[model samples]
Target: MTDIYRKLYTSSMMPSINLPKHYNYIGAFLSLSCNLSCSYCINHLVGLDQRRKHLSGAEWVEGLNRIQTEGPLPISLQGGEPSIHKGFIEILNGLRKDLNVDLLTNLQFDPHKFMDLVDPERFKRDLPYPSIRVSYHPETMDLAETVNKVKILHDNGYSIGLFTVAHPDALEYIPAAEQACEENGILFKTKEFLGEHNGKLHGTYHYEGSVFSKEVKTVNCKTSELLISPEGHIYRCHHDLYNKITPVGHILDPKFQIDDIFRECTYFGKCNPCDVKRKNNRFQNFGHCSVEIQDIE
Candidate 1:
């Protein structure tokens, strides 16, 4: 479809899906296909349906534009490598200008092409973190090459940051990577490894028996973030998204509205680390978790 026609067509088709009073995030997973297959990938911590279809860029634009946030909330575009989507550039260009956007990438795409087409201002925001974050995997990527890409983009007025997971096996390499980034004046940060390595789990969780629990049980769960899959299906948490659990609604479903209430969950033990991890809330407070899971068995 032509750019002008797509813009005009997608502008006003669906009703706005408003965020709950306590909502802190909106995850827009454009695609789950990635170039690298790191052994410790969190997406595979439980299970992932690789065959799920991704929404075309036009469909994504049309559905995502219907969201209305409380403040300057950015819809985070993430994936195995969101840049792998065929219409990655087009989706980036089509979203509403007032709607802020964030990217989690592996620096796998061409930087020159990105700079040529996308305006740097599209991602710039007054926030504590950079809008574009490049996840550095020591096993799958070369550190120097990744840093070079960051330099190229940051120099061209893009607010970008380099982050690495402190995996148990790769801990030795993270220091040098951070040092390289620091010496070159690039922003470098480390994220806690979320999944398993060897025999034990690696991260702190809000709920006990949530990660790799021996037995499954039922619990009531409520989430503050809107999690959308590649196909635009809504999930209560990352576990449901990766495991292909039935979604609450599709972004394109016209009659849909935020329920803002707890829903019963059967896979309480196999919850994703991202949902249960004790982390900072939107205000940067320390004891925040994405989902409030209750009545565990």
Candidate 2:
């Protein structure tokens, strides 16, 4: 007797997760387990729970298909490393035809296998950033190896880019690494290191006391992001996400709805840097923030 796997719910059965008008990002945390443990990962700054259950590839496909969106924004697949998910390729192939996707990885996975299984067109999109952003961690990964993998993927039609964080410890090594990537026809960029390094906190935040400040206060916060965890739990912010705080809703629930309004947060001072960081919006505009915080109480 043969059997077929069934989806938990159909798109029709589930309510649409209407995205906000000014929403800048839609991040889907496919898996939070990384092969290389970087000390500066923001997820760990707020205490990440890696033991949480990850939704199966089919479940992820079913859950994400219910999202209602428009414009240049694509559902970003990220994590400790999104590629580590056992069903990573399947999830890529399973998203609905209308939805495009992006990936943030460390380039540690088998690129050849990825190329063989995934159609690069799935991630291709007309955007300022590449569909796949590979991080080059000099602390744990070899730069030559990273560049080679990226070159191969790029040569194979994958829209890929390489980047590194300018952590104080890692700064001296970036110039050479950038040269290597450029030599191979790969565009490399650097991101601001946003965590503690050698006893001093390093980051620029929009909120006065949202991150790295030793102050904890209550405030009304609104998010312009859809932060889904590995288990399909949607959270208000990255702080709530890494800490595994109460989620707004579960993706699989028929009653799940997205409230793009400010909600009370007593842990405002303890926010994850990602939430309060001043960064670029979807249009590549400067000075974009993921959450709006007001009504201090």
**Candidate 1: residue pairs that collide:** none
What are the lDDT scores of the predictions, listed in order?
Answer: 0.86, 0.84
Best by lDDT: 1
Off by over 4 Å in 1: 1-11, 46-49
TM-score of each: 0.94, 0.94
> Residue-wise lDDT of candidate 1 within 1-297, one digit each (tens)?
234344544447567888877899989888777789888888766444388788889888887888898777888999878888888889899999989899999988889989999999989776688899999999989999999999999989998999999899889998899899988888998888887777878898999889888888999999999999998889999888887797998887766688998999998888888999998776667888999988886
Q: What tens-digit string does per-residue lDDT give for candidate 2 at 117-169?
A: 99989987878888899988888998888889999999999999998999998
Model 2 misplaced regions, further than 4 Å = 1-12, 46-48
Instruction: Please give the distance, in angstroms, between residue 192's alpha carbon in candidate 2 and its true position after superposition.
Output: 0.6
How many clashes show up per model?
0, 0
